[model samples]
Target: MFSKSFVRRALSGLAIAGCLVVGLPTLSFADGLPGFTLWGGVKGEDSLNFRLDFGGRAGSWDRYRLRIPAKKMKLAVEQFAISYPDYYKGEFDTKNVEVIVKDKSIKLQEVRWNKDNHLLEIYPEEPIPAGSGVEIQLANVRNPSFGGMFYFNCQVLSPGDVPLLRYLGTWVITIS
Candidate 1:
C-alpha cells in the first residue's frame, strides 16, 4: 500500500495534470480577430455592417455582404460608391457584383473597381428607391496579404440631385 503523504501527492499531481489537459484546448493559439476598439469617430448610426461569408484570412478568397439600412437611405440612390483606404489591395470581381433588395437580386448597370481611386462603384440599372434596405454582394474577393483595419466609406448619388456624392455610412472591415 502507498504511504498517506505519497498518496496525497499523487492525487494532487493527477488533478493538476487533468486541469492542464482540459484547459489547454481553451488556451490554444489561433489567428483570430483583434481586440475591438473605437478607432474611428464614427457614431453607431453612421456605421454599416459588412459580413465575410468565410473567415476573413489574409490572401484568402471570400465574399462580402455590405448592408445598407433603410434609415440610411434617405434619398433614392442612383449610384453607390465604396471608398476604401489607399493601402487596401484586395481584388474584387466586378462582373459578379450584385445588389440585393428584399432577397432579390437587382439589375446593375455596371460595377466598377477602380484600383487607382480605391473605389468600388455600383450603378443600378434603375435607381434604388428611397428608404429601401439594400445589400451589396461582392463575390470572389481576394483579401490582402496582410491583416489590418480597413475603413470603407459608403456614398450615394441621388437622381436629379446635386452631382455630389452624399455620405451614407462607414464599414469598418478587419481581415485577420
Candidate 2:
C-alpha cells in the first residue's frame, strides 16, 4: 500500500520533468528562424501568395532572390512584367535581373526599364507554360538602403486569343 503524500509527490515531479523536456526544444527551434518583429506579414490577396522576407547584416543589399510560383490556367503568363507602380520612386537596379526556371537559366529577349513610369517589362524568349514556375533573381539590387514595406505589382499577358495583360495582384514584401 502506497501513502497518499508519496504518490502525490511522485506525480508532481513527473509533471515538471515532462514540461521541461517537451518545451525546451521548441523554444530553441524558433530562435533559428527569421525574426519578423520589425516588419509585418504580407498584406494583399493573390493565388501565389508566397510572401518574401528580407533580413541580413544591416548594410548588405547586394542581391535578393524571389520565387514567383506559376499561376493557374485561368490567366497564364506569356510575357510578364514587374511594373513598379507610378507612385513608388525607389532606386533599385533592374539591369542585372535574371529569370531562372526549374534550375535552368532563361534569357529575357526584352528587358525594358522605364524609370519615368517605373516599369520593368521582362519578355522571355519562351513563354512560361501553365503548371510551371519561375524564380526571379534580382542581382546587384540595392533594396531600399533602409528598412520598410515595399509593394510591387505583377501583371501577366495570357497566351493566344487574349491580347491584354490581366491584373493579377500585388506582391507584399517586407524588409526588416
Candidate 3:
C-alpha cells in the first residue's frame, strides 16, 4: 500500500491536472480575440470598441455595434465612413444601417455599401452634434466565410469642413 503522504501528494497532483484540463479550454474565446496581443503593435488608444450581437462565427448573420467615443467626436460629423481591408468579403445591410446617439436612433440621409471600395458610408440627415458618443449599428451583417481578424477603420467628415476624412479609430473585429 502507498504511504499516506504519497497518496495525498498524488491526489493533489491529479487535482491540479484535472483543473488545467477543464479550465484551459474555457479561457479560449470563440471569436478568436486574445486577452492581450503580444506581436501586433496596435496602441490601445487607436483601437475602437465594438460588439457582435450574435456570436461572430464565420458565415453567420450578425449585428455589429461600432462605437465612437465622445472624446473622439469633437466635431459635428456630417458623415461617417467605415473602411475594411480588401480581404474582408463580408456583406452589410445598407438599408438597415443606423446611427444611434444617446440611445436614440438618428435619421440617416443615406447608407452606402461600396463593396468594390470596401467602404460603408453612413450619412445622417443632420450633423451629429459634437461631444456626443455615436454608435453605428449594422443590423444584418453577413460575416466573412473565413475566420480571421479584420480591421475596420472609422473616419468622420465634419460639416462645412474641407472635404477631408478625419481618422477616428479602428475596430479590430474577429470572426470565428
Candidate 4:
C-alpha cells in the first residue's frame, strides 16, 4: 500500500510535467509600454483601416470602418486631415484636431487624453454598436516616413447621456 504523502508527491510531479508540455509554447510576452505604444500585431488578425464620415445628427454617429487592402503600403496620398467638410467645409491647415481616416472627414464631439494609459480616446457624438469593427483616423500624423511596424489601439465611448470608454482592439499598421 502507498502512503498518502507519496501519492501526493507523484500527482504534483505529473501535473507539472503536463503543464510544461501544453503551456510553454503558448505563453505571451509584451513590452509593457503604456499609453499608445506601437505593436507589430496583436492576437493574429491585423488588417486595419480608419474610415471617417461626417454625415450624422447631434449625438449620433455612423460607424467608421476600414478594410486595409492587400497593398496598404502603396497608399500614396499623404495629405491627411480630419475636418467636418459637412460642418465647416475646410480642409487641412484647419487647426481643429480631428481623426482623419484614409481621405475622409468627420466632426467629433470631443477628444480626451488618458494620462494614465497614454491613450487618445475619441468620442463621436453618437452611439456605436458593441463589438463592431470600426475605423479610426489619426487626424494629424501622416504615415511613418520610414516604413516599419506601427501599432494603434482603439477605444470607443458610446454616444449616450453617460458613455464609458471601451477598448476595441489593436491595429498594426504595416507600412512596408
Report per-prediction Cα RMSD to one decimal.
Answer: 5.4, 6.2, 2.9, 16.3
TM-score result, candidate 1: 0.80
Structure candidate 3, residue pairs in collision: none
TM-score of every prediction relative to native: 0.80, 0.63, 0.85, 0.36
For model 3, give the RMSD to the true fold: 2.9
lDDT of candidate 1 over 1-176, digit per residue (tens): 99999999999999999999998886543223222455554788887877887767889998888999988889899999999999998999999899998789999998988899999999999999999999998989999999888888999999999999999998878788
Q: Give the alpha-carbon lDDT of every model.
A: 0.87, 0.61, 0.88, 0.39
Q: After superposition, how far is residue 20 of candidate 1 from its true place, in Å?
A: 14
Residue-wise lDDT of candidate 4 within 36-152, one digit each (tens)? Answer: 335534654433444334321223223333333323323222121122212221122223354434355546666654434444445555443333333454333332234344445
Q: Give per-candidate clash totals.
A: 0, 0, 0, 4
lDDT of 2 by residue, 7-30 (tens): 999999999999999999876554
For candidate 3, report its TM-score. Answer: 0.85
Looking at model 4, residue 171 earns an lDDT score of 49
* Per-residue lDDT over 11-90 for candidate 3, one digit per residue giving the tens place of the 0 to 100 score: 99999999999988777543433235567835799888888888788999999988889998999999998999999988
**lDDT accuracy of residue 130 in candidate 3:** 99
Q: Which stretches of candidate 3 lie over 4 Å from their true place?
A: 1-35
Candidate that scores best on TM-score: 3
In candidate 2, stretches whose alpha carbon ends up further than 4 angstroms from where it belongs are 1-60, 71-76, 85-89
Reference-based TM-score, model 2: 0.63
